[model samples]
Target: MSWKVTFRIYYEDTDAGGVVYYANYLRFLERARTEALRALGFEQARMLQENRIAFAVRSLSVDYLKPARLDDLVEVSSAVRELGRAQVVFQQQIVRAGEMLLDAQVRVASIDPVRGKAVAMPKEIREKFKTLMGTPA
Candidate 1:
């Protein structure tokens, strides 16, 4: 299943031309993922404190199809496309109303903060991600 979150475009999210700055989309996507995990009962802060595990973007690719303007309400949707022992690939999109504004794929890796190395996610976390991978969006 896909997880979704909505955000309102603000003046700070846009350029002088009133269109969302390209880089800001990354921030929006990050928030969507963070909220999705939070909704699943996996708080990032707690995960770090308890498991010493943090997720970092391993790779990302985005296709900008349309621009979102200031004052627009946009929705970001994310679904698990692939799940690995230590990483997940997410299929994501940003939409305005029913129209798509951007398409992206983001790969996130579980890492050991102190060692600064990729590590397998805890079993409970992997199982939780499996639920997202199996459901239909």
Candidate 2:
């Protein structure tokens, strides 16, 4: 299922021209993804402490479709697109006032925090991710 997280644009999230900085959209997407995982029963601190693993952004492709000015209320919709042994791909879109402002595909790799090498996602976590992606195996 898709997760929707709403956020209001702040001065810090914008540029001098009062438009959201292009790079900040990535950060917004990241936060929404984290919240989505939390909704799926994964917390970053707990995952790191118990699984010895953390997620790292492997790649991200973003399309800027429109602009959101300061004080605009935007919602970020995120969902899993693919869940693999070592990576989870997510689709995210940022919308404001019924208009899509940004669209993105983000790939995050599961890795051992200490060794910094890739690893399989935990079975329970993988199951939830598959369910979220709606391609359960």
lDDT of each: 0.92, 0.89
lDDT for each residue of candidate 1 in 1-137, tens digit (9 for 90 to 100): 88989999999999999999999999999999999899888999999999999999999999999999999999998889999999999999999999999999999999999999999999998888776663223
The sequence of per-residue lDDT tens digits that candidate 2 reaches over residues 37-103 is: 8998899999999999899999999999999999999999888888889999998999887888898
Best by lDDT: 1
Winning candidate number (TM-score): 1
The residue pairs that clash in candidate 1, if any, are none
- How well does each candidate superpose onto the true structure, as a TM-score? 0.96, 0.95
Tell me the lDDT of model 1 at 101: 96
Range of the 10 consecutive residues with the lowest summed lDDT in candidate 1? 128-137
Score candidate 1 by lDDT: 0.92
lDDT of 2 at 6: 94
